[model samples]
Target: MSITNNGISIVPSFSLEKPATVFNMSIAKGRFSFDPELAFSLEAKPWYSLFWFRYNLSPKQSKFNMNVGTHLGLNFVNIPFPNAKDSIQIQKTDRYLVLEIFPRYKFSKHLTMGVYYLRSHGLDPATLNALNFVTLYTEISQIQLSKKATLGISPQLYYLNIDGNHGYYLTSEISLSLQNFPVIIKSTINKTFETKVEGSKPFLWNIKLVYPLKGGKIKP
Candidate 1:
């Protein structure tokens, strides 16, 4: 139901049939920047399944926001074997425990800066462990495009470390939203200018179209 210009090397999610659902709610509030919220998400594909829960501290009036989250992923992967009975590939499942933290400072209504940290560890095969990612990003949101449309742009620089291999990447996300339309458009671009990691893609891009339920109810 979606398309991309290029596929990711590390996470090859090019296949269709990926479904996801999310729930988010604000729980309590005390002072500025002390709002408490909770979010839960579940996603599944033919090759993998992922679930995550996040605790967020974001206030609409505050200049600072933070999110702490945890993820559990089950990945069905195939590897090449020297000699196999049925085929030259073997299937394996990798269970991962991922921890994440993101904190951002809103400099103005249009600009924000953030750093995201993630640590992933494999539980089943201990050898497939210790993956780390750090991302530094800045975003400009809600730029007026037209009377009924808005635009958002975000650029990120990130470092990935896995199994003693390191790589650096630059990525950007662009989004367009309309006030009365039910379809939203989003695009992403990624490039790896410097890397020592294997199977890393030098450049990747994708565009997604999301249609909300309101489309069924809105009249033309």
Candidate 2:
């Protein structure tokens, strides 16, 4: 569960991965997932779900590593009628398939840099749109405050293109956590530097309280 400034997001997720293995799989809902660009509403209500399967392509000891993944998504969208006079909103269901690739270089134990790319293809042309998203990011981790408490920060620059409309944005997240704690605190900020897309917000911010219910560890 995550309690954000906007609302509460209840995300129930399942993960299947083996240590030292090259393959991983996960499924979750209730949040915006870029892998398939499953857009959830800003409110707490969830209307989309995604399943992702990934495989690592680099050796275990490599400083630079690459991962390739795919996302299968089912989304429910509220599509307004073409007539502007009609005050009713119509709901429609759609599916999406996306391809993802990310490559990261670990500069040190505390620093890492990466680039992520995702391309989403809509299954229903009548209701959904294709998307291309790319992110360049750097992470700083393991800033210790105590033996068990740590801080992590990630800064990202991203580009999004949907149906020929495009935008450039900057985003970041700061997280604080304790080693044995079930709860983590995170704050995210996003700003649109430039955009030609409609309905894009110039700035957005949120604070999230996240809880882990199962086997999880904060590497931090």
- Return model 1's CA RMSD, one decimal: 7.2
User: Which pairs of residues clash in candidate 2, taking residues 3 or more apart in a chain or in different chains?
Assistant: none
Q: In model 1, which range of ten residues has the least summed lDDT? A: 32-41
TM-score of each: 0.72, 0.74
Clashing pairs in model 1, backbone N/Cα/C closer than 3 A? none
Best by TM-score: 2
lDDT of 2 by residue, 44-157 (tens): 334566677667787768899888878777766667877868777876778888788889999998999999998888988674377878899799999999999999999889
lDDT by candidate, in order shown: 0.66, 0.67
lDDT digits (tens) for residues 154-215 of candidate 1? 98888988888888888888989999887778777778878876667677676666554421
For model 2, the superposed segments whose C-alpha errors exceed 4 Å read 7-45, 79-90, 216-220
